[model samples]
Target: MASIELKNVIKRYGKGKTANQVIHGVNAHIADGEFIVIVGPSGCGKSTLLRMVAGLEEITEGDICIGGRVVNQLEPAERDIAMVFQNYALYPHMSVFDNMAYGLKIAKVPVDDIKSRVDKAAKILELGPYLQRKPRELSGGQRQRVAMGRAIVRQPQVFLFDEPLSNLDAKLRAQTRLEIQKLHRELGITSLFVTHDQVEAMTLAQRMIVMNGGVMEQFGTPEEVYTRPATTFVASFIGSPPMNLLKDAPDAKPGVITGIRPEHLDITPSGWALQVEAVEMLGAERLVYGRWAHSATDQLVIIRTEEAHAVPVLGTTIHVTPRADRLHAFDAATGKRMMTA
Candidate 1:
């Protein structure tokens, strides 16, 4: 396993005046064997950044280093990295064992060594029993495992995943995620996974880079990004139901944006008066959607409550207080986090 580093990485298309920059000055030092996830919405350049690191896209400027060697000009084959793409681009006629061993065979590895590597990868991915099966006979998750095993047999310094789980059903995705986690623990190869799903990022990442419009919005562990987001975009994007950003909060400081998570707001006898707008009964909890009482903006606020608690009546004014310790404040102009004084 080797560490990966991105030093002021930038990517653009076209030349001169018409050059449209997509990745803007991204920089990060990934520790040896660290699992990093690049996460963002669709069209946010996450895939573009990953492709640049894989040597698939030429970077406009800056350097990409794998194992301390700058590889900006290297071909993808020279980068010592393996990639598992969203599509399982397997040769349908070939069996799983042959698919996994194809790369080694191309490199002219000995017949016995090819079998050794394929066997090792297949065992780890639990594809041993189906090693002789063709792609058409296996399930989607099994096919994806074959794709991953193909990468694993290469035994490269780094592994790059481009939304490898996006094609699976919810249950299969969850199962594959566990398998990937186990694979990492067993092999401990440095990995950079790209996905648009935040839950996947939060679950699989040791550290995560949150991107927006090709810019790095935040880079930290899942807890850090979820609890202390560096920017308003992060504040609203990282959480389920997301942290509420209120510009016209009651008793709000002028020009300061107030941020609070739904669970951090509690029903109180007196505080911010909110009129209940809607209620959603989730399996184990209830979500109460309310609007600022008699306000011009009619800002919607969500409060999360336990299933045991009484559901507030729709249209009734309820007072909810944001916990003091949980309140987050940000700058309205720049959308950046405001350090607590």
Candidate 2:
């Protein structure tokens, strides 16, 4: 395993006045053996950043170092990294064992050594039974495992995953996620995963980089990013029901917005009066959407509570209180978090 560093990385297309800059200056230091997930919505440059690290894309500026070596001039093959892509680019006619061993064979590795490596990877991925089967005969989940197995046999210093689980169904995705976690524990290779799914980033990352509009919005552990979002975009984007940003919240300053997560609000006899707009039952939890009774605009506030809690009647005004300690403040214009005094 080796540490990877990105120093003020930037990416741009075209030249001169026609240049369309995508990735802004991004700086991050990922520790050795760390599993880092780069997450954001589509077109956020998360994949572009990963491609740069893998040497698949030329860096327009700044430096990318892997294992303390400057790899800007290095080709993808020389970067000592194995990548697993969203599409399982498997050889349909080749059996699983042969597909996994093809790279080693091309490198002129000994037949016995190749067999040993392929066997070890197959065992780890629980694909020993499917080794002789062709890619067309395997299930989607099994195919993905084969792709991962192919990478494992190489035993590279780093592993790059570009939405590797995107093709699976929800159940398969969950199952594959656990398998990936187990795989990481067993082979401890430094990994960088790029995904648009926040659930993947939250569950798999040792640290996560949240990107937006080609900029690195924030980089930190899952808890840090969730509890203390650095900006309003993160606050709204990371959660399921998302945080409520109230422009006309009680005592909120003219240039500021009050942010509150749905779970942080409580039904009370007296507090901010809100008119219940709608209520949704979601398994064990109930989500209550309400509009501020006093605010002129129609922005809605949501409250998440256990199903046992009484659901407020629609169109009826109810009092709800926000936990003082749980409230987040942000500058309205800049959309940046405002630190409490």
Candidate 3:
């Protein structure tokens, strides 16, 4: 296992006046054997940054070090890293055993050693029974495991995953997530996974790098990112329904934004009156969507409540109160969180 470091990393396309910069000075210190997920919306440079770390893309500036050695000029094969792509890039005609053993064979490892490594990886991934089956003969989840098994046999210093679970069904994705977590616990390899899904990032990452428009929004534990976001973008992007930003709220200074999560707002006898616009039933809980009553602006608000609670009728006004301790204050002009007085 190895620790990875990124110092002032940047990526740019073209050159000179027409150059378009993508990644903007990303910096992080990934501990040995730590699993970090790079998460953001599409076109946010998450994949680009992962590719840069894997030596698949050139770094425009700064240093990338693996196991304390700088690798800015190293080729992909020389970086001693294994990558599992979104698509299972398995050869159609090769059996699972051959697929897993291909890298060892290319490196001219001893025949016996190759067999041992392939067998161990197959057992770990539960693909021992499908060793003889071709890629076409296996299910999507099985094929994905085969791809992972191939990576495990290499025993690389770091593992890079580029949205590896995006292709799987929801149930399979959840199951595979658990499997990946178990694999990490057992092998304890340093891994960096890139995904556009916040739920996956929150569940699978020991820590996460949240990106937006090539800039590093925040890098922290899931709890910290969700509980105390560094900026308005992080506040709105990390949650499911997202944090609500009330502009020009009552008793608030002009140009200040107040952020509160859906679950933190509760129906009360007296508070901000919400005019219900819509309701959505989601299993054990319901989502109430509405606007603050008597306000000229149409800023929307969402409240989450248990299904057992009485559902408020559409068009009816109900009072909702935000938990004071849970509220976040930000500077609307800069979209940055404000320090409380």
Candidate 4:
């Protein structure tokens, strides 16, 4: 395991008039044996930053260090890092055992050592039963395990996973997530995972970095990012159905933006009023969508409820109130969060 450090890293394309900067100066220090996930929407430079650390992309400025050694100019193969790509990148012709042993073979490791390493990885990944099968014969989750096993065999200082579970079905994705978590606990290897799925990031990462517009918005543990986001963007982007952002109209708060998570709000008798626009029945939970009832506002707020009884009809008035202590305020212009009562 090795600690990874990014010091004011930047990635740029072209020069002069046509210069396009993808990653602005990003600085982060990942502790040894830590699991960190880089998460953001498409085109937010999460993958670009990962590629730069993997030595697949050039660093236009600053430095990248692994285990206290500068590796800005090193080749991807020479960096001593293993990466599991989004597509699995397995050889179609090779059996699971062969696929896992390929990297060791290329490195000219002893034949006995190769067998032991591959066997151990296969055992850990629960792929021993399918070691003789080719990539085509494996399920998506199994194939993903093979890809991970390939990385495990290398025992590199760093493990890089670029949305490895995105291709799997929902159930498979959930199962694989648990497997990965268990694997991380057992190995305790330093891993950097990149994903667009916030749920994956939240569940898998010990510490997560939220990015937007090619900049690091917030870097913290999953709880901190979810509970007390540093910015409105982080709060809004990290939640399911997203944080309800409403303008604290002149009669309400004085902040540029007021936020209330769907779970933090409730239907109240003496509070704000809303006109129901839509209600979605989602098994155990229902999503109530409506807007504030002070004449008109274009934005809508969502409230989550577990009961289906007495569902509000559309266009009907409903009284809604949020816990004052649970409300979040943010700068209207910059979108940065403000902590207050």
After superposing candidate 2 on the true structure, give the runs of residues whose Cα lies further than 4 Å from its correct spot. Answer: none
Clashes of each: 0, 0, 0, 0
How well does candidate 1 match the true structure in TM-score terms? 0.98
Per-residue CA lDDT of model 4 for 122-144, tens digit only, reads 88899999999999999999999
Model 2 per-residue lDDT at 93: 91
The pairs that clash in candidate 4 are none
Q: What TM-score should be assigned to candidate 3?
A: 0.98
Model 1, 159-257: lDDT tens per residue? Answer: 999999999999999999999999999999999999999999999999999999999999999999999999999999898889989997767778789
Cα displacement (Å) at residue 196, model 3? 0.2
Give lDDT tens digits, candidate 2, residues 202-319: 9999999999999998999999989999899999988888889888788888988889999999999999988899999999999998888688676888999998888788999988
- Residue pairs in collision within model 2: none
Please give the lDDT score for candidate 4: 0.91
TM-score of each: 0.98, 0.98, 0.98, 0.97
**Candidate 4 lDDT for residue 3:** 96
Evaluated against the true structure, the overall lDDT of model 1 is: 0.93
Candidate 4 minimal-lDDT segment of 10 residues: 247-256
